[model samples]
Target: MTMPHKTIPESNHAKPVNLRIREDVRVLIDRAAKIRGKTRSDFMIDAAYRAAEDTLLDQTLVKVDAESYQQFLDILDRPPSGAGFERLMNAPKPWQG
Candidate 1:
């Protein structure tokens, strides 16, 4: 005889998060979440995740020689590339029609 396997739900892996926020802050978050059609928990999670990524990015340090730094500045001083910006500017505007 074989034993049946047990199935686990995704919620089992999730941990509860508690926040002690001001009533005004809670209302503001609820408004923003409603505009985006997401539950308050989902909106808060997305915001917290993005903030974490930004915090991580801020910790990164790039090392470059003096010559490389000047080259980077020189590139920044140049005008925008001629790939498609010019063409887009000259393109017809439907709003005017």
Candidate 2:
């Protein structure tokens, strides 16, 4: 039995982006899009989105050695100190007056 395909919902796209590519690159993209049964725009949008996500994630994700990771956890566990505690204690509350 053939199952129905799930498609992304259509949204109002008001922005226009102009892309410049070599003819050979365009042909390659067209061929790949045809093979995947997607229009060139659909394929490019999906590929661009994936690339953008990976770029952002690469910047945000971090790897640390076990000792450094333990140090990080230790810092988080440390209590607020000195000036910060004094400020909190002296700060005026709206409920007081």
Number of the predicted model whose TM-score against the real structure is largest: 1
RMSD of each: 10.5, 18.5
Clashing pairs in 2: none
> Model 2, range 5-93, lDDT digits (tens) per residue?
44545679746778999999999999999997999888887788778877998899688999999999999999878998989989998
Q: CA lDDT of each candidate?
A: 0.85, 0.86
Best by lDDT: 2
lDDT of 1 by residue, 1-97 (tens): 8686332334657889999999999999999999978789888887887788789999999999999999999999998869597888889999988
Backbone Cα, N, C clashes tallied per candidate:
0, 0
Q: Which residue pairs collide in model 1, if any? A: none
RMSD of 1: 10.5
Relative to the true structure, candidate 1 reaches a TM of 0.56
Query: What TM-scores do the predictions have?
Result: 0.56, 0.53
Candidate 2 wrongly placed segments (more than 4 Å)? 1-9, 61-97
